[model samples]
Target: MLRLVLAVLFSGALSLPASADVSIKRLFGKEQRALNAIPQTHLVSLLERSKAAKVSSGGITYSRDWLAGQPKQSGGREWRCLAEALYFEARGESVKGQFAVAEVILNRVSSASYPDTICGVVHQGTGRKYACQFTYTCDGHAEVIAEPRAFERVGKIAKLTMKSAKRPLTKGATHYHTKAVSPYWADKFPRTATIGFHHFYKQPSRLSRN
Candidate 1:
């Protein structure tokens, strides 16, 4: 009698719907293919939206879209100083690279070893050959902004960094030099980050401050 009951239950189970046998992977495969069929521009727009929603330090998030939408107006003296420094030093760099350079400048302003103001720190060694903190300041060439678009981009970056963004992208580095040349001081400090064409470092004693 027990054998008869077991055989009857097994036959009834086999008669259930074939859909019940479908695996999870098979069920989701159709959905995944549909997502893959989306247009590239639409996918990119979705990604940009997600990035814009992400918050960095101090509740600031920067993206190309955000920067492009900013007003094209001049800022105060400090803003001009930072914007000019970025334009001359890293205009050709990637957007993130430009921001990294700005971080170094702001880091110096907050450090004990450097000047407290952006202009002071940027022009620290100007007028002396090979002594300027930034080469453009003492390169003996007029500081003319020939590229309006580039200046505008850096200006937005400067404003964003000065106001709401204070995250240390360069690992608390206060100094950086291009990859084409190795400066004597680079060896004296610990290397922190290498962004785009520049190598960043922080003085060993200043690590605590960073």
Candidate 2:
């Protein structure tokens, strides 16, 4: 059953749209509109930074500029726990992949064994030396948004996720891994979802479900 489902998702691997991830739709909340809503000031030469801009996904349109006006980060003014998770969790991945990883995180947030908040879930594996989760943040490597085009694209997806765009791709998964590394944990986990090169799993959420 898992193989059949995964094959279907992987075969039609087009760029995922905002309407594809359910957890994202619940978080972003439907305020994001307009293509050129705002300019990327952080990327402007005035800030001595590179310029960032929006990209259309063939027939799909997004609100990258609009999101620029809402600078949410882990520590920034618009700091949304989910938004921060999306930025760092999969910033290096394609927009769809980034969102895919984020859905896993959100799935965890809503699960019974993990932290209810995104920050807690993200930082859960931190400070354990080699025992931390989300290998990218604890691997002694800095997270840099080097690919501006891709980052901008993911950033927009992040914004859309914050604005209630729904696809529910992760199926309440709180864990994930890239296809390249066949982590031992993968063998132990019961797969919940798979999108692109990522696989998601659930180990329960921490929040009390009414």
Highest TM-score: which candidate? 1
Candidate 1 Cα RMSD (Å)? 11.9
Backbone clash count, each prediction separately: 0, 22
lDDT measured at residue 40 in model 1 versus the true structure, 0 to 100? 73
State which candidate has the highest lDDT. Answer: 1
Per-candidate TM-score against the hidden true structure: 0.69, 0.54
**Residue lDDT tens for model 1, 1-210:** 223444565576577676654653463465567666878767655554454533366544445666677777578999999999999999987666788899999989988888999999899989877678898999889999999999999998888778855545788888899999988888888899997799999877735431
Model 1 off-target regions past 4 Å? Answer: 1-55, 58-63, 206-210
Q: What ranges in model 2 sit over 4 Å off?
A: 1-89, 165-167, 204-210
TM-score of 1: 0.69
Show the lowest summed lDDT stretch of 10 residues, model 2.
43-52
RMSD per candidate (Å) reads 11.9, 16.6
